[model samples]
Target: MKIKLKSGIDGLLFGMREKDVKELYGNPSRSYKDDEDNTIYLYNDKKLRLTFYADEGFRLGYIIASHPDTELSGTKIIGQEWPALEAQLQQNGLKAFEHETFDSVDNYFNEDNWTIFQVEFGTVVRVEVGAIINAKDEFDWKFK
Candidate 1:
């Protein structure tokens, strides 16, 4: 589930909490405040920034995932459980994705034999991809 997102300065302006911002992003390399009482978190390497107000609701004033001055990279999905993830994506009406097959699908799966399926969501978007077990496995499971 790896996908790239659009980056714009206006995309940064929003109302959200500092903790919520932290939860969405891992952590900030630096933090500061402004005259308007907005708390700012900056993650330079990731090209992300979040600003929140101190008042109740901690209104998120701005969020700059990537500056207009730079190019942004897609999000990476690693250490994810592929099978369940694929199902979840399907459930989300993400059928917008297209599918592709690997030439040696079975070999990459580390299985005795396998069939692979992949779903693509536009360009550089999160897609669901997985493998299928043959009738033999299904038969064995039914018997068990």
Candidate 2:
């Protein structure tokens, strides 16, 4: 699937409702609440994990796509070496990542758009993208 920067992969925008997501991808293989008490829909077959935050009007707030299958600008993002992947991302107009590592895993964060590439053993394992709109104190949204 193609990555759309701050937007979502494919047509799954950042501010989409759970009902809308269900309509598009059908029922998830498994459904449960995450540590944060948000609802998580896991589509194992599609290698996708979508999180809907109850506080954000239950809109789709987080998306986690697994390795090898997810592509960015036609380039497969997972399983590539860190330096090569970083250069490729820069060539695609995404640049200047702040890398954080713990144990054997590395996370490259682009604060520019909240796109995170989680790498392990020098290869990317997953990609996460999401948005949290603070447009209003309550009952309002401005997608970022």
Candidate 3:
């Protein structure tokens, strides 16, 4: 399925209610509470991770995708090489800003939106979409 990375993914926008997620995904493969006390819903078979903030009434905070089939702007981002993905994103008029990573991984985040691509050995393995607070502090910031 084509997932939009505009403000969220697959109609699951940030700030959405947790019950909405359960209704859409029909129960996650696994669920757990994180260190921050947020409940994380994991659909490993679907390659999706959804996090809801406890303080915000369990509203959706982040949507993560690691599936090879997930597409962004008509391009399959997960298995794409760094150069190819970079070119595709640029062609789509999306500006990518490189994020610091301790390991041998290359991370690029879109300046215009909450889209992040995690590349290892030149191939993208993960993509994250969420709000800036969740993206920066909760997700990508740990890499820096």
Candidate 4:
């Protein structure tokens, strides 16, 4: 499945309604209310998680795709080596900035509204795509 930046994943658009998501992806494996009182749907089999903002008519606010089969610009983001993924992002005109925490390293692609988390020294375990709201100076961290 090809992932679209700041827009959607596969055929799922960011502004789509909650019912639309369930219709396309089937019922979520589980659902939970977020801190903001919005609903979050998880499709564990597909390794996909979607967050909806109730205030915005339950529109899709975030998409987190962790399946290795999920591709962006023909590049498989999950399970990709860090260096190769970084190179791919650069070649695609997306700037990658590194953020290191106590446990893992995260690479943020600001323009693409995506963040890649490193599982190890070289492997990527997760990819978060959404409308990043807390972009502080050169670092883009929060996904809204």
Candidate 5:
């Protein structure tokens, strides 16, 4: 899948319904409400997770890509070390403006559209992209 900042992965844009997903990728491997009561669709074969919240019109709000082949600007995300990831970000004209490290895990977040990368043991474990929730805690559907 290709990551599109402030937009979506590939053709699955924000504010799309579940049926749109089903039409594009068939049925999910698993679907359920998460701990926070947000709906979740796990596509195991694609190593992706989709999250939707009722308050957001139940539209697709987040995407978690864990597949090593997941590409962003022609660079693979998962399994990339921080240095490599940083380089990829720079090369793509994207930036990780904030970062934190805890318990040997590194987290990097892009301020633009909230693409987060979680790295463990020196390699990226997963990358998460989501719609922009503004400072007032309102969904910035303008990005759609």
Candidate 6:
């Protein structure tokens, strides 16, 4: 069965403590400590780093995920040449839904991380991200 959960800090109330989120998601590939020393989590990759920003109250500002999987036909994948990847694709091949039809070679996002690409694919194909439900009111923020 598929389940959805809120993404922002409000979602953190569903038994998802800060430590738990870290443990499940793994140490952010990198982290940034604000002027106040509040830590913002980051998942770093060659092309993208999923970042989590926190406000004074620890509420998530937003989630920005980018993809760099699409590549130019003549360019190199990590400096190895695009032809090599294409050749490999033809050999190993990807899943049916993992492919995209790029109208032009210039329409690709160049980055080192492929996680964002996978996320984009999932979203474009109706795959879901963390969900938000049972929204917490100001009163909900109070944890005695």
| Candidate No. with top TM-score | 2
Q: Against the unseen true structure, what C-alpha lDDT does each candidate score?
A: 0.39, 0.81, 0.77, 0.74, 0.83, 0.33
TM-score of each predicted structure versus truth: 0.35, 0.88, 0.84, 0.81, 0.87, 0.31
Off by over 4 Å in 6: 1-17, 35-38, 45-61, 68-144
Tell me model 6's lDDT, rounded to 2 decimals.
0.33
Candidate 3 per-residue lDDT over residues 3-89, each given as its tens digit? 665556765767767687777778889999999999999997889999888876787867888988888888888888888878878
Model 2: how far is 101 from its true place, Å?
A: 0.9
* Winner by lDDT between candidate 6 and candidate 3: 3
Top lDDT prediction, candidate number: 5
lDDT of 6 by residue, 52-120 (tens): 334424433223333233232322233333344445534643212234444432122212112112222
Ranking of models by lDDT: 5, 2, 3, 4, 1, 6
Model 5: per-residue Cα lDDT at residue 47: 90
- Taking all chains together, the TM-score of candidate 5 against the true structure is 0.87
> lDDT per residue, candidate 5, 1-144, as tens digits?
888877778777777778888999999999999887888999999998998877677889899999878888888888888787788788777764588999988888887868898999989999999987778987765334
Query: How well is each residue in 1-144 modelled by candidate 1, as lDDT tens digits?
Result: 122121112223244456655676657899998787768788786655555656534655334432323322231332224455445545743334334444522111212212122222312212111122346752111111
Q: lDDT, candidate 5, residue 128? A: 92
How far out, in Å, is residue 90 in model 1?
33
Evaluate residue 28 in candidate 1 and report its C-alpha lDDT on the 0 to 100 scale: 85
Local lDDT at 59 for model 6: 34
What residue pairs clash in candidate 2, if any at all?
Answer: none
**lDDT comparing candidate 4 with the true structure:** 0.74
Model 6 residue pairs with clashes: 5-131, 6-131, 6-132, 46-112, 46-113, 47-112, 47-113
